[model samples]
Target: MKGYYQGFLIRDWQECDRNNAANILHSVLTEYGLPWLPTGADKDVIKVEEFYLATGGEFWVVEKQGKVVGTAAYYPVKRGEKAVEIRKMYLLPEARGQGLGKYLLTELEKTIENKGFREIWIETASVLKEAVKLYESSGYQAASGVETPRCDRIYVKYLPLE
Candidate 1:
């Protein structure tokens, strides 16, 4: 899954993309007042293959002019019937306000649904107002049980299986 979207190359995680992906995630997390815990919630950022692809999930990196600028990923979970949790969705400041976040989210939902995932979960902090807004506006309803130490809100959306 790779292509140019609005001049940005969106592609699956590659071995060479490890460092850049981690950096972008860390930068955005810190910018939003969240700690960069490589040994905790963010551990997957450094081991994309083992944490995502190897587990029937996916991680993507967005690049612009040869510079990595964003990431989006999701993995299977047991909280619901055929469910997956969206994680590691981040974008550099400069790459924001251009609909890339919305685009990535729409793309993720479509892919997840196509892959037979019936429900999607998301955990986020209130400080990330944009994310909260995006989730709500996209039909994700407020939920509970935020397992991440830094996240305070949870949202879940169920896809209609065709």
Candidate 2:
């Protein structure tokens, strides 16, 4: 389902959105001194819907007048797992501070929660203090054990009980 929030539009990713989504992902990551593209990055960009759709997952983009300004995605951390990991939750500088990050995350969390995911996991570099703040502000707790050297921090949020 596509949605409009403030002046931006949020929609399920389309094949045509590959470059726009990739550019946003590349620019945001590198701005924090992180690499532009991770291994197999193109698979997510080029086959976004294909990669996530069959697995009870989703990838979305926020666009302003047809240009991607932000992106967020969720995929199963592993087969038959109750936990889902968030990825690419980045917004351009122009789109920051307007509650867009929270908006994207809130939407994803709700969708995943409804899908019976017990918890959501997020990984981020310690250098991105603002991102850590945002995730913590949204009820994520610092989880022990780094999932990878690529990101030094991991956060987890258990879904609410029924």
List, residue by residue over 15-131, the lDDT tens digit for candidate 1. Answer: 999999989988998898899999999999988888899899999999999999999999999898999999999999989999998999999999999999999999999999999
**Global fold similarity of model 2 (TM-score):** 0.89
Best by TM-score: 1
lDDT of 2: 0.82
lDDT of 2 at 121: 89
Q: Number of clashing pairs, model 2? A: 0
Worst 10 residues of 1 by lDDT: 1-10
Give the alpha-carbon lDDT of every model.
0.93, 0.82
Report the number of the highest-lDDT candidate: 1
Tens-digit lDDT string for candidate 2 (28-77) = 87888977644554356666766677777888889888778998899887
Worst 10 residues of 2 by lDDT: 37-46
